[model samples]
Target chain A: MNELVEFISNNLQLLYILILAIFIGVELIKNVPSVLHTPLMSGANALSGVVIVGALLVMLQAKPDDFLSLGLGFVAVILGILNVVGGFVVTDRMLQMFKKKK
Target chain B: MNITLSIIYLITTIAFVIGLKMLGHPQTAKKGNLISGVGMGLAIVATIFLHDFEVPSINYILIGIALLIGSVIGYFIAMKVAMTKMPELVSLFNGFGGGSALLIGLIEFGNFSEDATQTSTIIAAIIIGSITFTGSLIAWAKLNGSMKDIRLPKYNLINNLIILALIAFGAYIVMYDSTNLMLIYLLLFASLVYGVLFVIPIGGADMPVVISLLNSLTGIAAAITGILFGNMVMMVGGILVGSAGLILTFIMCNAMNRSLSNVIFGAFGGGDVAIAAVGKTGGTIKKTTASDSAIMLNYASKVVIVPGYGLAVAQAQHVIHELEELLTKKGVDVSYAIHPVAGRMPGHMNVLLAESNVAYDKLIEMDNINPQFPNTDVVLVVGANDVVNPAAHNDPSSPIYGMPILDVENAKHIIVNKRSMNAGYAGIENELFFNQKTSMLFGDAKSALTELVNELKNM
Candidate 1:
């Protein structure tokens, strides 16, 4: 029973990766209208900042002795967050310039 | 601890989502940034408590010192650096990220033996990290003007051979489990050199594509590092970077009417040759007075303004905005046509225009504005060249042949505001100048635009 559980756990990561690869492939092949590309890309880049969450989780799960990993994870999360936030701010600032005056 | 971690992750993800959404429009980007910042802070706090290692005095001191130095330097650089240099700065930052990943992988490899599980991780990290590090460094050099934009002698064949040899050597070291780490280091060093050589040959005009490519490389490297460390977040983040970089690269390539392969292998350096090819018609160009041009502009029912790198160089955005205001007051419908690949970086013109408080609605992308040119009474080309060149449409043997261009010639009147009839950065003469409908208005962009503004005010 323990062996079966271990096998399943190990395979979970592979399955997740497969799903992600498929999503990326689909996105690439689909013809996104040119007008939407900039907005969509900006959106996607911002969403990519979601890695910070994973970083946070890893840090939280780190054992008491795993200081180096924890510290690195923290730094990653911080930087990732900054990227997401800064990117969004700049994007919005750009888009706002295009908005019709009230 | 698990709950805290989960919450932190959830927050980070939300921030990412919000940030991306905000990026789609300029209005909400600031809020998006704040959301992401909050998420980052949570992640940092969660990381601090993750491991219970007795804090080493020296390590803490080192971290503090590094942070202080980095922050101080970063602050000064950010404050002092011109906005024009932002793209190069971004490339440098990407290099640092790639370097970090490589350093982490090397450290990890030194501490561990190449087991079946570790083999894939180590190889992936080393290859991706090395590529990113070198590629970004080269990009930085190109942007900083440290390297010429043209290809070096026999660069194509030599670069390919070197890359192949390095890959083969790296594979051998990884497969054989040879305790000699020097071989792996050597491979990495070669790759770094190759990256610089590869990017150096690419011209300034291709910097946007280079930036996107390096960004993608950084992502791939980060992901590989994550895999080696069995870090789920790193893996996801890396993949994101790779995908985003690729998408941006594609967009930039499309804008240039060039393929990825062409951008990578094409020897675009012989700009001087292209310039010489322009028929030396000794006939001097007829120059228009600012007052005359302004009178035409003031009376026009509709006008389309096309901007380019020269506008950025002159810092004439404010004057242009004022001109737009004056034109609008005269009941002339005004709009701007923006080429995707204009300026040194992606969305560079937009940033400059926004800084000058130009209305966003007035700014239109190439496709949207291209169709509207026929009905425009006046087409004003401001510091723009290649994008407005008619050779793209008419000339078959032209280097920029088959590339899409703005149909500025279709307008009843075309006013080209440039310093002189010097060929653009691409070293190609704009056939638009020869068009019977076009008139040359020569002077510095800012001064010329300012004079036009003054004339319009008097009119």
Candidate 2:
């Protein structure tokens, strides 16, 4: 816990970015019209798939003898990849429907 | 090198926000999705080559194989699914997101033994992540029509016990020295059980709300993952999703006229009550033919079309679009009144209607269009039942009572197109169909609309 606090104090700039990011996310799109709510929600679903990065990082840092990490990392990597691939692709398909015809 | 990579990461973050902002507007939503996709791709590529100074020691071949396998599975499944099935597919993807986070948290829980805050954070992620994973899967199954709410004896009691146990276990793990692996594993499996039990009692009527809540939890889990890894992009991306999903869930709950707690614990329509309620029939409804409906539409000065899940089921989007166009050309004021939860998915009906090339401006929301229904000469309800049911207002015993519904009942002339007088998906008799102004037009929405088009053409 002390280490974390120390790290936070050291990386005050990144911490500010973190706090600012939340507001930018919350306030800017608060009034998303109902017509776009589902797509907006689904698009956000795709965004949460950003865990793929964290998952891959875990895999990279794991020791070779750490069978648990290897197995868990493998599972994490597969699921993360699936999430990004499926989420963005499906979101694209849904949004494509919003096109107005001439 | 670090500075260059950080710049790339910053660009990726900006791109995600821009994408979400653009996603709010109908005209630019598709473009927004594409923009975000590009941003995600950029982030992935940069991370692969840039982040760690030392080359990654992880087996590159395994990750490659896994990526290949996952991409193929995800790609083909998504492409193969029809728009009507999109919600199920979405739930599955949401489940995957949550499951992955939970898996990572579980692995990390034992590793971060010395740090109290970090350990607690990992445990929180595991609990939320597990709930999201299983809850999403249940939502998917129910949406897919493959699962139903399980009614075990003393179901609520058992449910409470499991929840208490899970919470107690989570707290214990955080306090325990070194966070024993055995306890962590127990926490995971028990949490999974709790997740299933948590969602199993909610009826299909609340599926949309359930899916939205689970989606947000997944977002929250991702945010927690970001904290654990100290990844700025992941944390921001998660906060965006988490915030957006919560907002959407709130909107949907308002639209459905139910509170989030009610959706979670009030034990909505399911099993016995739904069956018994549906078995109760409404008084005889007046029937009308396609020709009469066509004449009504042709002569009416204003028209409102209400589309629901059945509209997608019939694959009648094109026909509905054609009808709207024909009415427009004839100078009739045609608009759509969309209930917030109209279709299976959140915006499923809107997307279906849009796919048919319906004008974006013409699709109206329930709140905006409800008052307009009174002035409507004809309100055509196509494959929608629950949203238009007047029992939401008049019948206290109704499952969907006090729920906000469209004022289709207030319209001058109401025509409902359904294959039968069958109870709707909620298993509640839609009193809207039995309203004095309602006239039943029995047939597939597609065939009925097709017939109406043919009749209008001949006239």
Candidate 3:
């Protein structure tokens, strides 16, 4: 219980950031029309690949002989790039087809 | 955590917000996607070059190699994939994102920070990431027809028990020992099992909800990873995706008149009874030729086309466009009626039709078009069944009974094109096919539409 309190007290800023961002996110996505749902989904998907930053940090911070962490971070980096690139390219392709009334 | 990296992350966060907002409209969605992609690129470059990791000899070459391989494969697949296979591709990509988060959590565990908050966050990331990874792969396999829906006797009970056990085990590890690799692997294995079981019982008709739900899981996983690292860009971006996916899931469920829990636990559309009471349908099937249908379409004042997954399967979007043009030349009005859950995912039919150059304004949603059906002269249903099924309204015992469907029956004339009398993915009979005003034009969607176009031209 002491540890729980200590953790929350030490990280109150992160907690506030998380809560506020969730509110902003919910509000922003509420207005998207149904026709754009697929692209919206794929685009949001690409953004989740921001975890690649965490992978890079791990790779840089690992000790020279820590092969396991380095190898895992390397694979994570590759997967994150795949998610971001594939998601954005595909979303662009889909969005190009949606022509408004002439 | 340095000032330079912090400023860059803040810029990236703003870009993501504006980009997501721009995605709400058709006019700006493509540009919105490009803006967000630029933000991601900026974040990556800044992280590699400016971040102070303090470790000696960073492997720039290895990182460059990874980027090259991933980018080439991702670009080629996205470029080459047919529009019809989009849902599967999205599922596969989502799985890889989850895989990355899972590995990040595992790597973090190797360094095992003693902070209670970080430990809990790491556990959260690992569990959520593993579930998203396995669950998404299953959804992809099901969408691509590589696997079948497998339902155990009392599968929901089994799923619930596993979930409970996993939570208890996770809590135990967080409190007792956070650095044990064996316990972590056990947790991962159990989460993976739960993920597979959670998706397998859901029939193909409910794939939209499954995909959206998994997409949300990946986002939450990313956010948890961000919490562990205290990275603002990851937090904001992940939360945005998580909420976006949750909203979509709710929207899809509302369109179908089912709750999220019901969709997961109801195990609806088991195809064992595919040919349910065929003899009991009230009306006989009426067959019509393409020439007859074409003549009807040519003479009609206003026609609304209903395209389904079958349209995508037959690669008939282009031919349908041709038919639409020919009808227009004859002074007939043509538009498309789009059901919310029409294809495998939300907005699936729109993407397919758009790829074939269908105009955005002409494809009307269910609520707006349902009321106009009574005044419509001709309703063309191509390779679609469940969305137009009158049984959704009139038959109480039907599995899809309460679902909202396109009111195609109210139109003056209904013409359906299909390859056979087989049921749709939901495995339920469509009473719309047997209605008095309906005429069945049997053949592949592409070939049938082509024949109709040819017959109309010679007239």
Error of 1 at B223 (Å): 1.0
Least well predicted 10-residue stretch by lDDT in candidate 2 chain B: B53-62
Question: Candidate 3: which pairs clash?
Answer: none
| lDDT tens readout by residue for model 3, A1-102 | 786788789879887888888887788788677788888888888888888888777777877778888788889889989999999999998898885645
Candidate 2 local lDDT, A1-102, one digit each (tens): 787788788768766866787678777567877777767767788888888877777776677778888788788878887888898888888888877666
| DockQ for each model | 0.17, 0.64, 0.75
Q: Per-residue lDDT for B75 in model 2?
A: 92
Best by TM-score: 3
Write model 2 residue lDDT over B1-459, tens digit each, in one string: 367667876788889999989998878888988898889888777766676634345555556776788889989988899888888888899999998899889788767657766887798888989998998898889888898777677778898898888888777776765556888888888889888988888878788888877888888898888888777778888877887787788888887878998887777676666666674556879999999999999999999999988899999999998999898889899999888888876677888888788888888988899889889999999999888888788878788889888998788999999999877877788877777898999999999999998998887
| Candidates ranked, most accurate by TM-score first | 3, 2, 1
At residue B47, candidate 1 shows an lDDT of 49
Model 3 C-alpha lDDT per residue in residues B269-367, reported as the tens digit of each score: 765545563445766989999889988998899999999999999999999989888888889989999998888878989998898887787789999
TM-score of each: 0.84, 0.92, 0.97
TM-score of 1: 0.84
Candidate 2 — which pairs collide?
none
Which digits, one per residue and each the tens of the lDDT, describe model 1 over residues A1-102? Answer: 785587569868755873584356235423543333333344344334434334443444444455665465445444444434433443344444444444
DockQ of 3: 0.75
